[model samples]
Target: MHRTASIGLAAACLAAAGVAQTASATAPETPATYLERIAAIDDAGPAIHAVVAIAPDPAGGAQGGAQGGAQGGGPLAGRAVLVKDNIETRDMPTTAGSLALKDNATGRDAPLVARLRAAGAVILGKTNLSEWANFRGDRSSSGWSAVGGQTRNPHALDRSPCGSSSGSGAAVAAGMAWAAIGTETDGSITCPASVAGVVGFKPTVGLVSRTYIVPISASQDTAGPMTTSVADAAMLLTAMAGTDPADPATAEAGRHAVDFAAALSGASLRGVRVGVLRGQAGTTPALTAVFDKALADMKAAGAEIVDVAFKPEARMGEAEYAVLLHEFRKGIDAYLAGLPGQPPARDLAGLIAFNKAHADAELRWYGQEIFEQALAATDEAVYRKARQDARRLAGTEGIDALLARHEVDVLVAPTTSPAWPIDPLLGDHFLDIGAGSLAAIAGYPHLTVPMGAAEGLPVGLSFIAGRWDDAKVLRVGAAYETVRSARLAPPSLRRWGE
Candidate 1:
């Protein structure tokens, strides 16, 4: 079958490129050193299956040319960052973990990638993600991709890493890269980072450019940093936050952009009014214990913890899903049409047909129900109403109301429940108790920092603020980090409940 052949060809390509090389025991000193680390852990040692392709040497490759004369000697010098495969890189194929895009090597850098390169980050490689960023099927497993296989959680090899930013989260937790980029529409970044035990920051949507990255909902899709600490997240955000001529949403980014890294030095929780959303925290007793401890730590650090109430409108969920389906069809059509060369599928319809023709690979575990819904989403008036209603419920009448009514600077809650068992038959068991949805739907800033573990599985404490309040959100998270318990270290690969 074509699916099987695509997998074989991908494996052969990696083998030919010698993706894994000899690794050193000490810290990585160069880009090649990081590649060695990825090889040792991601390919041979525990085989986490995080990386999809090891970027070829940039000398003479399109990477060098695509940088547009921006030299690498900025703040990120000597650092190496892994990119989510959904984001295009000039030197590697930008497959969204789908065989249909296995040959999508567009010789151009997404403005975000170019920014990182200009800031001196070595483009390490592309990390695997949920196939089609977990948009193709309703019952699709998180982290399972036909091109790179399933990306496992480093904490417990058997648990889900949470997608579609699965590999970006796991690789950072397992120490496979200095840091990684993750794109999110809803829970993609925060969910993975929380369960994987790392920091994930989804900035105000317009703060980062969405151009050249595969889209789901342009209104909600934004690339963010998934790192080991709040400081690193700030460092990456400083370089990444800017305007791009192509992404009109970012027209106001220049006015809001600031030196995020420098703001951390003055961060403090003293006298800060923090509104708590208890309803969003998970119901498990163990998880509650962890969250309670986090609240205590914040209160001790001089934060005013005020419990708040929030209830989503009855139709908000339906409207949000409708908005995503409408946007995915429109955005993906534009993205696929703009790709260079004879790419596999030209639009959503073509992608659906391609998946049908290769169902053994693409649909072995799940059917393309979401894809069908998206393709059939043809009502412009309904989509407009849905977008307006969803944004109002999640934004003006949702997060904005909570902050205004409570007289709080920001909001807090548990990021999500700990990692669930990875079951392909049942797909992702993502619980509804979390604080990411409102921020995501509102296109506001949301951040997750590791609070502690529940039953040996890590969980995160979330910090969220109104749109363009990114610096304030980061400062609060950093201040809490200083007073919180010791950060969770990367876990060794092991069996469940070990």
Candidate 2:
């Protein structure tokens, strides 16, 4: 039977038990209700295309149902949560926005998804993403996927939603879910959340398990929370974080996974040291003004601001790119090989072949040069060197050094410029840069909170700190969020130049 039909009576029962309480209504909104709401926004009304698949059962599905759902217990009780399509779910196919994986449903929840369910969160569905987490091709649109088409910016239909967590960000911004999970290898999570006017938190690499998510760069990839507020991000992160033996990087996660929401209770900017990364803030005059106003707000909140500067080596980007190529080849190969049954594409080469075979749909907009490059990158020695350079430059000599030199508790910058127009013919035009690269490569905690809107486009203020300081970063973000004056109005869905 369909989940909504089967669960209707049980949902009514749960509603009476206070499992479905919502801020907007006294009437209990069950997981099925959330699904219906999301479908209207994603498929019917605005046609945001944020959601790719809905779970027949949130507790568990074809993989074998778990007795967990809105009834699992805790802060997320009855909360409907969406995850990036790259993250596996028991009922929904984890397509990573690729048509090749449309039928590749593994019938297993990713460890992180299981954790969320265990915390009373109902796994609403999988959100669309940039295909292959935005690593499949060159000149590709940020939110387009062969499986789900394009996810338009909720702010402005003509604008880009960024990527590869584009749908996750957009879903939360549009209030389709209480919160969503997004994976970032670089700017995937923060960029989309910023552009979509939501809060996104990219925890330190080892702070969250990455098992069962689609691969890009093992060294850089991580799943995190995308929500409309920092407190919601904290609540989601609290459930999502834990040590997974299968993911060796998360060996220390158990140690860092404390009560993140608890930290927010004491969040205060008073007497806190804040480092302003003026150089990283883009030169867009309106965005710069928004950032300046944010800095002033921090001061009014009692934060002591100190200007800090750090320049990355020109080779850092090149080295990071090389490392990603090497790791994508090995990591994706292993992930595909481990799948339970025969899949259309078992490795990078197979994926490339599959795309070419279905080029009419997959390659209609762009070419998969990144896939080709990753498949051909067989030089382990060069990969090792590049990895070393990237880590040192981004970590030791970059974020870490800058923090120590400036004696600041945390660093802040404008996350990115306002959303740009989506151009299928030309691809992403990043009018300005952000602070995502340094923290992404360094495996540090990064948080982006909506700062303000510029020309009807939302931008965010980024908070980045040293590794394992996830709680601290959230606290600081929350502190700023509480005091910020700018509020994002609902998306206008306006045409370009409107």
Clash count for each candidate, listed in order shown:
0, 0
Using lDDT as the measure, the top candidate is: 1
> What does candidate 2's lDDT look like per residue over 1-498, in tens digits?
012222243332232222211211122245555665554556665678888877776534311222334233355666778888999988878888888888878999999998887777777788999999889888999999999888999778889999989999888776667788999999999999999888899999988999999888889999999887787788889988999999999999999999898788968899889999888887888999999999999999999999997666889899999999999999999999898767898888899999999999999999999999999999999999999999999999999998899899999999998988899888998864688899999999999998888887889999999999999999999999888887666655445456
Error of 1 at 263 (Å): 1.1
**Candidate 1: stretches off by over 4 Å:** 1-29, 58-73
Candidate 1, residue 52: CA error in Å? Answer: 0.7
**How does model 1 fare in lDDT?**
0.84
How do the predictions measure up, each by TM-score? 0.92, 0.92
Q: Evaluate residue 456 in candidate 1 and report its C-alpha lDDT on the 0 to 100 scale.
A: 80
